[model samples]
Target: MKDSNQEEQRPKTTFSAPVVLPALLGLGALLAFCALYPEQAGRIFPSVQAWVVRQFDWFYTVAVSIFLVFLLLLAVSRFGQIRLGPEDAVPDFTFLSWTAMLFAAGMGIGLMYFGVAEPLQHFLKPPTALGGTPAAAKEALQVTFFHWGFHAWSVYGTMGLVLAYFGFRYNLPLTMRSGLYPILRGRINGPIGHGVDAFALVGTIAGIATTLGYGALQLAAGLHLLTGWNTSTAAFRLGIIVVVVGLAGVSAVSGLDKGVRRLSELNLSLALLLLGFVVITGPTVFLLQALAENVGGYLSSLVDLSLRTFAYEPPREQGWFAGWTILYWAWWISWSPFVGMFIARISRGRTIREFIIGVLLVPTAFNLLWMTAFGNGAIWMDSHVANGALAQTASNVDALLFRFFEYLPATRAASWLAVVLIAIFFVTSADSGAFVVDAIGSRGHPRSPVWQRLFWAMVLGLTAMVLLLSGGLKALQALTLVAALPVTLILLMLCYGLWRGLLADQAHSTQDLAPATSFWSGQHWRRRLEQIVHDSTREDVFRFMQATVLPAMHQVSDELRRRGVLADVQHDLDEGATVRLTIPDPELRDFIYGVRIAHRHLPVFTVQDASEDGRAQVFEPTTFFEDGRQGYDIQYLRMEEVIADILRQYERYRSLSANLRTHLLSRAPGHSEPMS
Candidate 1:
């Protein structure tokens, strides 16, 4: 048996040079330029941002609206029945963990930075209504909800659905290129794929760096508020980045299951605690009434708000629309790849309906309540208690949240808690962003060294620092808005590819005749009973693979070659018990019939004590297929039965290939290969 410690350290994959090299070169070049020429970057970035808004603000608004509508349509369609992975595959993470992680990765920092700043800004300087009026406050919360609500999550949901569908269902690498498989076909394996992934990598870094910039500023401001130590300087912000990124590097090295998950749950808990504290201490009855009114107002105005560009309005209104709404849209788009990839990484095995609904509703619901509590409570305090004091310093957006906490009970503790939450949110965003960037650079290979994650985490921190040094928060937001344009185009193509892929998936399901191996139920009943009772050892499975599985595969391979069909069987070099037979098809997915020894931990009732190596384990020689269908143990099957099974799977593969409707499935590129 292998030591658990050694297994944890074992590397399963390596970087894809085609993706990694260019991405790093590009990132390094940008950072070097920004550090060297701060003035140029400051002017250039905002110019580019203004250009995007002037040229494509309508495009951003329209595309995001479509993404939301697309997801809703999919949820109500037959395609919603399709699972991300194989039909029988169960989710890797539980519902709570999944929600917490997605929430943390998607909007934790943004919410913290904008929760008090946004609503208060809109309230004080009303877009259309007069400032400091009842109508202005209502419109303020409504617009805040609109910006942070369904539209934001839909951008994420669209990217995530594409990745999960192609990556899990079609057995492609979980990278940006995979989402374009149907359109690009095998070209996804070439330079096109490399370029797509490189773009995604750069955009993810910019997005996360932008977010980290927000967190760093807010954290610095909170500390300054708490201790009055002149923490508002660039030096302090850089120090904050270094320390938080260092912590994030540590979390990234600890791996996702251990570090990101735990931190995300902690973030959610602290956020909720702070939220509850505010509601209890603030104008509780008024806040509750505002929550209901805010949700209703948002829902009622959602349609108009989704497509409203204010094109007919004056220049001031147009600028406001661009700076606030357009910028928010672009920020969400640029951040989609990072958040979307993270969500997809955790969302395998869920149905389309479940995935869309969960991704859309869960976070949006929380955001609405949060905006209402913070935004409404702030407005209420401004009117009733502070006499416009909170509104007075809303211009210093970073310190606004802490300022709002001052009028409440336990102001010091609440302020401290908010600071801690921002710090943790910073760490989670950095760590999760590191994981996503690494995945893209590695071409979505499942495993790489911990140092790679640390590398990306450092890259994130450095980028944020450079952006801040170059032009402060404006530079950060500008880069995000600018980076999102190209990514938006890519995501639109992703939508098309996803729709085609889902259609193919539905067609493939329709062509399923029956469970492929259901014909052999009790033909070897006695042998099956023996196999069931016997807890097979690794050596036992190896012997079975060598004696029974190998001969059967060779028999089929020889016959296929006799008929001039390409067939090859290869044994896994690392594991003698694992073997795979491949019959290559040039125009469609290859037919793969593989048998591998799967190690499973024993049930509690079956094991009283584990061996020194760790938990008690059992092994099974399970069959696998190229379509990612759930495999079953074939230990009881005789040599003839194994041969029969191989031929049966090959027939199904050929049959699926012949169906015209499975076009996208036939066009997807092969899985990621080992780096040489």
Candidate 2:
């Protein structure tokens, strides 16, 4: 019974019914479509893709352009210094590991598949420049960089920023609908929230399915290219899907730390080795020169590329833009939920500016280099060695990378390496995507169940296989674009919602800063001064929390309950002995006033020995609020003083919540509290 009570006191997360139903229904539809109606699916998938691309080309173009602009403005805004968690919080992952995960999660597989293909396509038939000319090669690199650069990461960063801010800072569930908390309020736990998450899940499946489609095909191509084994049949592709999905399941079961993170690190190492091989074995100096020029050309043409629509150009060039640039934007937007939430999960304590800048710039630098290495290498060999072979066959984009590798030394080894890299990238993406979608399905429960992870892994694989067998890769691509359409609108709302939430936080922070008056102004000040001067041990802090803090919290809770407000007291019997008073308001998010004996690095001035100087750490009874903001220590305060502090904090929370309230401002005079 004691263990049961402790378990009840501990924090727990669970799913909502409304979210699960719609998500499963969508999942089932995909499964049934692929398994039951294979032939019809094949024909319908391609037509659907073509129609969306044809009709909504302009919408996708405009939506993506705006996403990039919004990210830049948000980063430069006054809220940049705000940490995603508390004001004093630091980053969880270090810079190097974080950067590696960014590459691994965001663009690893796509870059491998399209690194050579996109650039060569642009070179073969430059939309604006003459084909097979010097200008075309430069334009090819520039265009590839543009598609894969700031806009894509900005879309991802915005989604991540919203989620991380709400989850860590505001105590909302870390999911897509939670980003709309400022707008939806508690309704986010309702049908509307379910709908938002459902869309994200569906989009996640489609986007990853598209990537898997590309991966399986590319893997098959590598196999045939290396050993002359014909792996192009539908049966062969299905086998690859089975193998990738099974591997993803193993990784998913292992969880993030041992599974995804380790794979991501390996992916980076293999990627570096392959990149070095290309840079060393292929056109070494030309690739370097092209990388520098590519950066310059990309900057020069950024705006033109961002906002371009072929109002005056020939229909063919317009078609080209719609086919390529718009498609990439839609693809990125579709993938943002999985990628963004995954990014958010890893980036708990990072500041807003650090996150936006690092997420945008780091992957982009690698993206530019990756494109230049493979893209430039392919172009150089086409012109110098293969005599335009790769450029001519750019139509068959999937196999183009393998063909380009044949021009270099150790063609078989390099081709095999490419296969392994794509396979690992495939597993990383699927495993991560499964984990993310499960979180979405379970209404943002981070540790729902292993079965959910495995279930989604199978769903993701099945979705990709179905698309490949039914509509082929084109079908998967089409579904991605179509699914991303609604999320574009959702993302716009989230931008405004994040801004509103930030304004409230900043206002609360400004108002909540108590005047730095003396906390030791009472008749018992001398006694407390002596206590403060000495090092307080864990037992001492716990005694203070239990005797003084806990009783004070119950007094406030009882008073609020008698005043017709819903109030409760909770005690956590951990090392810190945290105690909290929760006051919930249906019109706004709940307010929690909590305090714990948290550790801090001991003061530098107190250390006598040089070796032991910086190592000592001490505990301080620290106050933490619902908004993830930290407050001053109340360890020395009496019960009356602690109760007073709670009231003051509650008043400040009410004031902040009032400013951000859009609806339900009025209450009936005789109406009681929610509990009352």
Candidate 3:
């Protein structure tokens, strides 16, 4: 009886209904909606997708703005004294695992498809403003790296840094709430939190929607390339779905440590082997020269390439930019949140600076190498091969990969290897994506029940099936960027929140100082505080409260002297009777209250009293009593009431200015600070 009673008292560890019910219902609704109104649903999906595309472009603007802000803060912190967190202690995975996972997760299927096609497309219709002749093969390699290099990695790296900081340092949950925790910590349980979470959820759904659509297209393309099958039929879609779901189900069951990691390793090895084959068998001199010259060109053009907006400026080159550069950017931006969160989870214990450099620079370098090796081989063949056989037959990218093998000595064996590599690559991408979706749904922890992951994996596969059934691979490709659009706004919000969090952290560290220290002798503390304030705002009292308070005392003394009053007013003022004024700033009051609230729910600091002039003041004892009671109380409750009332009014105003409010609320700590 006692055992039964104890068991009843124990907390239930079952999955929450909030997490489960919505997912199940969402899946059912999607399936049913598609079934009930197939044509309408298809059109609606794309129509909604158009909104997503616009959002994606908006996100690019936001990302660029945030990136600049981040760099500025970094510069300020260098000059001022600001530190956000203690040194990270997470172990860095060795190069093999890191590269394998990074390559598989970051590029995967996209790389395989675009390796040959992108360069060729550029060769055929080069950007007109760049003054390259049509079929000018020299620019092929340069264009390839331009497309695959730093900008794509920059988006991924930025997202990853946010995820790592929140997950490892803050002891927060792994959902969208945790991702935005730097900005929305206490508000996570509120409507604001719910909206953020929903946005993240939608982003995940959208990414999967795009991926599923593309995966179906690629599967059909691969079949058509290798087996000469007319894969444009409805049956092809069902077959692809079955294969994807079966593979994903197996991988989902195997879990990340075994299935995903092993698959990544295999994919990486296959990719390396393909590169080696090209380097050895293809025109070696031409390939190496192209790589060296293109790399140099890419390095020189990096800044321009990174900032190119492709805004339909030159009417002649508009199609080229829109079809290639803009589309790719949108695709990458859409994938950023998921990829970033996953990278962040894996990147704990690294510094913010290190995380950014590694995620942006290193992976981009690798991508450049990958593209140069594969893209150069195709360019070489197109330029110098016997009869333009490679270019003519290579109608699609998948054919290009295998056709390179046809030039090899062991054609059949090489073709088999290519097939195996393709399968592994798809599995790696699909599984990694599944894990990411699970993480987003579970909110970043590894503790989400296995069934939840499996359910999502199935849903993703089904989405792919629907896309394939509607049209062939071309149809899927057309819709990929469209689905990724809405999530772009979510990413912008994330960036804002991340920046704000970093700034806040810097401020907190700077302002916290012992009371006994003099400003000159406390230069280290002063510098740190100054750095924090400079990083976000000079008026950031949160960063330099102690320093600011000390200076304010001097200002008061100088004002009194100017008024022909005695200089020793500090000694005459009644410390016990001085009142601490409270104002109508919820954020400010929250900060003040936060300082007072203890782990045990008791107030650590309190209002001491009000002055004769009706101003309120708060104080702490210079010396400790036996009971160590701080000399304060809630003497200004009426002031708090008034502040609360004003806060409500401010919220109304905020609602009217939603975009501004979002920008303000989204600013992460190091990005923005409230005025003292």
- Model 2 C-alpha lDDT per residue in residues 525-639, reported as the tens digit of each score: 6877787688877788888898889999998888888989989999886743788889877655678899887877664533264357457677767888766675776767878
Q: Pick the candidate with the highest TM-score.
A: 1
Tens-place lDDT per residue, model 3, 1-676, is: 9967865664433333455456556655655666566676667665655554444543554464455445435434541222113453644566567667787888877777777777766666677524224245556667678667766776676567656666665666656666666556687756665555555554555465556566555666666656788987777757766776679778878877788778888888888887787778877887778778878988898666666655646755655655566677777766776777667655655566656556666667777777777776776666666356766755665466666666666766666666676667666666777777777665555556567667777767776665455442333343445644545555666677776776666666567444232222444565546543432222232223233332343454466468774332122122232212111223221111111211112222224432234433223212211122342221122222323423343354445334444445433334545444
Per-residue lDDT of candidate 1, residues 472-501 (tens digit):
456646776788999999999999999888
Any runs in candidate 1 off by more than 4 Å, and if so which? 1-9, 512-676
Each model's lDDT comes to 0.88, 0.83, 0.58
CA RMSD for every model?
Answer: 17.4, 18.1, 15.1
Q: Which candidate number maximizes lDDT?
A: 1
Q: What is the lDDT of candidate 1?
A: 0.88
Q: Residue 497 CA error for candidate 1 (Å)?
A: 0.2
Please report how far candidate 1 places residue 288 from its true position, in Å.
0.8
